[model samples]
Target: MASTAITTLSGGLVSVQASLQSRSKTLGLNLSCSKSVSAIRGLKVASNVQIDSSFLGKASNSSLWASVVSKPEEKQVFSSQLQPQASFKVAVLGAAGGIGQPLGLLIKMSPLVSALHLYDIANVKGVAADLSHCNTPSQVLDFTGPSELANCLKGADVVVIPAGVPRKPGMTRDDLFNINAGIVKTLVEAVADNCPDAFIHIISNPVNSTIPIAAELLKQKGVYNPKKLFGVTTLDVVRANTFIAQKKELKLIDVDVPVIGGHAGITILPLLSKTRPMVTFSNEEVKELTVRIQNAGTEVVEAKAGAGSATLSMAYAAARFVESSLRALDGDRDVYECSFVQSELTELPFFASRVKLGQKGIEAFVSADLEGLSEYESKALEALKPELKASIEKGVAFVHKTAATAAST
Candidate 1:
C-alpha cells in the first residue's frame, strides 16, 4: 500500500510541473534559464511571482518583473544604459553676475550642451569651479576679463550677453542706458570678432537699447545676420502667462499671452484675447491683467525691497531662450518663443512677438490675432506704439551716434 501511494504522488507532481512549463511556453515566457537580471530583455512583462531576493541579480531580472501584463503597448522600464549624443558649446558672458550663475547652471543641465564657457571681468573662476562639480556632461570653463573674451567665445554655438549693471530701486531702464550701453558695445564687439556665427542673445538691462547697439556693432563688423540676433523679451511673456493664469484660475502651462513691442513699461503690451485655452474677460479684468503684466518687473523689484532686481526670473527666462536657440540650431522647426527681433510686423525696426525658431535662427515672425482682439486690446496696442517707436529710435540712435563719433575720431 505504501509503495503504490508513493508512486502515485511522484506521477502527479511531474504532471503538474510539465503543465506549468507548457503554459509558460505558450505565453512566450522562458523560465528554464538559471540566471538573474535587473530587467527583462526587450520585453514588457508583468508577473505576480514573488522572486527570491538571491535570484534578483546577475543573468536575468525577469524574476523582478511585477504584476500581470494587460497592455501590448507598454514601454520598456529597464535599467539599460543610455547613449549620450554629441554636445553643443554655449558661452555666457558675465557668468559671475547675479543672472549669469543661475543661467549657467540651467544651461549646464541641458543634455544638448556639451561645453559651457563662462566669462566675466571678475570672480568667474569661482563660479565656474562651483558649477563644474555638477555631474552633468557639460564641461565648465572660466575666462576672466577682456583679454580672455575671445577665447571664451570661440567655438561657441550660442553667446549670451548679460554683462552690465542692473537696475536699482526707483531707477528706470533708461537710467541704465549709458553704462550698460558701453558694456554691451564692448562685449558685442568681441562677439563679432570671435564667434560671429553664434546666435547672440542680449540680456543686459535696457535691452531695448543694448540689442540695437549689439546689432549695429555686428553690422559694423560685417557679420550681422538680422535673424540671428535676439533681445531676451521672454521675461515679459513669462510674467504675462503667470498673471493671466492667476486671474483666470487656469493652469500656468496652458496660458498663452502674446507680448509685443519693446521690453519696457508701456511698450510691453500683453494681448489677452489671444490667450490659449480661451477664456473671456471683462474690461476691468483686461485692464487689471495688462497693467500687472507690463509692470511685473517693477513688482519683483519692489518685492525685493531694494535688495536686488529680478535675477532669478530673468535667469530662468534667459535659460529658456538659450535652450530654444539650441533646439533651433539642432534643426527643430517646432520651437517658437516671443523675442525682440528685427521684424516688419510693426513700423519699428525691432519688435517683440512670437517667432518660429529654426537652424538659421528666427525662422519666421508669427502674426498675432490682431483683428480678433478685444476693443480694449486694440486701443491699448495703438496707444503703446508711440512709446514703442520712441524706444526703438532711441536704440537705433545710440548705435548710430556712437559709430559716427568713432568714425570721425
Candidate 2:
C-alpha cells in the first residue's frame, strides 16, 4: 500500500510526503517545495528533501541505487547532487545575427549558466525577450548598439563573438574579411575594456584572420592572455566527426576527429589517420573525407543557394564548446576540446589542436597529437602553412594599418 500527503508550510512553501510499505519495510520521502500549490505545474523538487533511512537499508543490496545509498554521512542527496553550485554569466555578441540567435537559445538552456547577455547592433531586445520565455535557469538580458556593449560584457565570465556577415554563394571566407575584420576588432576592443579576464571565443569568419585581429586588438589594450583567447574551430571538428561517422557507418557519438591548422579551405586539416577507435582508411577514402571536411562550409552555403551559411551547425558546435568550457570552469578534471589559440605546437604562431581546458583557461596543449603524422597528412600539413601564414600576416597588417591611419589623422 502507498500513501501520500501534502501540507502547506509558512512562507508560501508546500511540503509533499510519500510513503510506501512493502514486505514489512517502509520507505518514506519528504520533499520541501519552494513554490505554492498553484505554481506546482512545473515545480522543481527542492534540494533539501529528506529521505528515510529505511529506504536506504532496503535498497542497499540493489546495485542500481548503490551509489546513492553508500554515502549516508556525506548527505549526498540526489537533487542536491544534480544542482550546479557554480554557474557563470555568458555574453553573446551579435545575438540578432543568424548564428547568434540559435546560439543564444542553446546557451540559455544550460543549467550551468546563471545569466545570458545578448548584444547586437539591432533587434536584440526581441531575441532576448523570446529566449526569456524558455523557462530556463539563465536570465536573459539584451543590449543594443555600441553604447550598451560594455554593460553586456561587464561581469561576464565568457564572451562569444559570432557577430559578422554570413557567407553567400561563390564568396570565399576572405571576401568576408574586410567587413567582419572591423566587426571583430570593434567587439574585441569592447571585450578587452569590459571583461578582460573572461574567456573570449571568436567565431567570426575568416577565423584564420579574425583571431589574429582579435589577438592584436587585445594586445593593444594590454589585456591579452594567450590562454583565454580562442578562435572557435569547433565547427570544422564537428563537420569532420559527422562526415567520418557517416562514411564508416559508426555511431556519431562514438566518432571524434581532430581538426588542425586554420579555419579556411585548405587550411582546415582533418587528421583522418588520428581518428579515435583507430579505424583504417584507404588512400582514396582518406582523400575524399579530407577534402569534404575542408569544404563542408561551402557545401552548406551552396546547398542553401545563398539563403544562409551553416548557422545551425555552427551554433551547435559553439554551444558544445561553450559547455565544455563551462565544465572546465566548474572544476571538471578532464575537459579537453579542439580550439585555435596561441600555440607552439607548430611553426605557426597560432594553431588549432586538442587543448586541456581548466579554471583559468587553457591549462595545457595536447601537442603530442601532432607527432607521427601519416605521409599524406604530413604533405597536406606542409601545404597549408604558407597560405595560413599569409592569412595571419594579413590580419596583423590590417590592425597595424588601421592604427597607423588613426595616428596620421
Candidate 3:
C-alpha cells in the first residue's frame, strides 16, 4: 500500500518535472527508453515525491545564475575581438541662412557624422528638427543667435563657418571680405576658445584672406594647429569640373579637374593637363572653360539679379568638405581633398592643394600636381601670388588691430 501511494505521487512528480524541462529548457527526452523504465521503477519504491515551491525557486535561480555568470565573460571576449567604427561631431555656423539648410540636409545624410550642430542668427530650430527626423545616426542640435555660438562649438570635431554677407552682381570677394572677415574672425575666436582642438573649415569669403585671419587669431590664442585649419576652396574645383565637362561635351560625372591656388579669379588654376581619362582640349576650348570656371560665381550672381550668389553650390561644396573632414576623423587613411592651408608649397603663406587626411588631420600635402604647369597656368599662378600675398597680409593685420583694440579697451 505504501509503495502504491509512492507510485501515484512519484508518477505525478515525474510528469511535472518532464513538462517543466521540455517547456522551459527545451530539453528533449525519450519517455519510451530503458532509462525511463528505470526512473519509473526507482520512483515507485521511493518514500515521498511532493511538489514543493522551494524546488521551483531553486530551478529558476539556477537558470538565471548560469546566464549571469557565463554571458558576461563571453560578451567581453567577443567585444575584445571586434573593432570600433569611426564617428564625428560637425558644427555649421550660419546654418539657417540660404546655404545652411541644404548643407545641413546633405550632412544629415552622411554616415560618417555622429552629431551635427547648426548655428545661426535665426531660423535654426526648424532646420534642426527637420534634419533630426532623417534616418541617419547624426543627432541634430540647433543654436540661434550670437549668444549660443560658443555652445554650438563646444566639443565640435569640425567647425564650418559659412557665415557673413554674400556677393552682389558687381562685388568682388574683396568687397564681400570686409564684412565677412569680421564675421569669420569673431566666430573663429569663439572656436579657438571653445574647441581649440577641432578642425576649423573656413567657408567664409574671401577665403584667401579669411583663412590667414583665422590662422593669426588662433596663433594669438596659442592653440593653433595648422593641419586642423582649412579654407574650403572646393567650389572652385567643382566649378572647374562642371565647366570643363560642359565645354568639352564630356560626361560631367567622370571628369575630375584639379583647381589650385587662391579662390578668386586669375588666382584659381585648373590643372587641365592632369585631367582624368586623358581628354584633349582645343586652345579655344581651354580658354572658354577657364573663363567660365573663373567667372562661374559671377555668372550665378548676375543670374540671380543681385539678390544672392552661389548659395546652393557653395552649400554643396561646403558639405563635401565637411564629409571629407568627418571621414578623416573616423580614422580613414588616404582621404585626399583640395583645401587652402598654411602651406610651404609656394611662396604664399596659404596655398590650396590636395592633402591626405587622417586622425592628426592633413597627414601630408600632395604636391604631385604642382610639379608642372602649362605656360598659361604658370603665368596666371605667378600673377595671383602678389594679390594673394596682399590678401593674407591684410587678414593678419586685421586680427592684430582687432586684438590690440580689445586690449586697449
The top-ranked prediction according to TM-score is 2
RMSD of each predicted structure: 14.4, 10.0, 19.9
**Tens digits of lDDT, candidate 3, 1-409:** 0111112221221122121111111111212211221122112212122222222232210001000011212222111111114557889999888888888887776555678999998889998998898755578999998899888999999888888887765677667878898999889889999999999988888888999999998998999999999998888877876777776786555566778888888788788877864788777777777888888888998898878889999887887677667656755553667889999999888999888878888889888888777777788788888988888899999888888999999
Model 1 regions lying over 4 Å from their true place: 1-86, 170-174
All candidates: TM-score: 0.79, 0.81, 0.77
Winning candidate number (lDDT): 2
Better model by TM-score: candidate 2 vs candidate 3: 2
lDDT value for candidate 2?
0.77
Name model 2 segments beyond 4 Å from true.
1-83, 169-175
Full candidate order by TM-score, most accurate first? 2, 1, 3
TM-score of 1: 0.79
Residue-wise lDDT of candidate 2 within 251-311, one digit each (tens)? 6555678889988899989999889758999999999999999988879888988788899
lDDT of each: 0.72, 0.77, 0.71
lDDT of 2 at 295: 89
TM-score of 2: 0.81
Model 2 lDDT-worst window of ten? 60-69
Candidate 3, position 150, lDDT: 87
